[model samples]
Target: MSKKTVFKTASLTFLLTLIFSGIAFGQNWQTDFQKSLQTAKAEDKPIILVFSGSDWCAPCMKLENEIWSSDEFKNYSAGHFVLYKADFPRKKKNQPDTEQVKANKELAEKYNQKGFFPLVVVLDENGKVLGETGYKKLSPDEYIKHLETFVN
Candidate 1:
């Protein structure tokens, strides 16, 4: 194969691998609050609602990388919690739909009225607030333990 063709093929293969692997390993973050509530109730799990400014907040990005995207948290939370993300992306291209923006605003009013970025709220299956936290420099296991304190 020509060098150009080889490069293209390699790039395509890499992209595909990333996409499929992320699907297999990523944490599932529900976008709809009502749907998450139903799932939480059905699964008998607490709801972990996160409010983040994805494009603008440093702490938010740190938490996402260090905790939410960690293999340890992903494996543990898969069975224990219903995850939801309320993202406010300042970048125009990253903004969610209007309805989603509205819903996120409502959630913020109810749970994060202080407008704290990277806020993590633990709620009962019925959506009552159990506890809230923020970015902490801890290992995934320790973070999981901290979150469990809110639930149990």
Candidate 2:
């Protein structure tokens, strides 16, 4: 190919790659539970509420890397679930605002009474609990299937 033709082809390829990769990894995890509830109601989607100790919990980190951050989960979850993360980070810098902390605690009281680090609770739009789970040794596809069981 000519130099100009090659440059055009490379630029087009790079742009397409950027676009598709953004779609693949665009998992919008809402930090505010109330906002996520509103989105769930409006979208008619189930809520995936995750309780995690991001800084101090090993299992939580594993779950984050293995499932939540996976392309399959991100892409699928975007269209199907309203994601809410109730993080209890131990690091000083990672700590959220007091109000957020309080909200997370309240959510824990109702859904994660036992204080599991990597608890996953699926709920309906109106905030009814569908099911609860924890970190499992499974692939992204398998994990998605497991979460779907709660909604179905």
The predictions' CA RMSDs to the true structure, in order, are 5.9, 2.8
Writing each residue's lDDT as its tens digit, candidate 2 over 1-152 gives 99999999999999999989778877998988888889999999999999999999999999999999998999999899999999999899999999999999999999999999899999999999999999999999999999999998
Model 1 ranges off by over 4 Å = 1-26
Deviation (Å) of 46 in candidate 1: 0.3
lDDT of 1 at 110: 96
Query: Under the 3 Å rule for N, CA and C atoms, how many clashes does model 1 have?
Result: 0
lDDT of 1: 0.94
Please give the lDDT score at residue 22 for candidate 1: 68
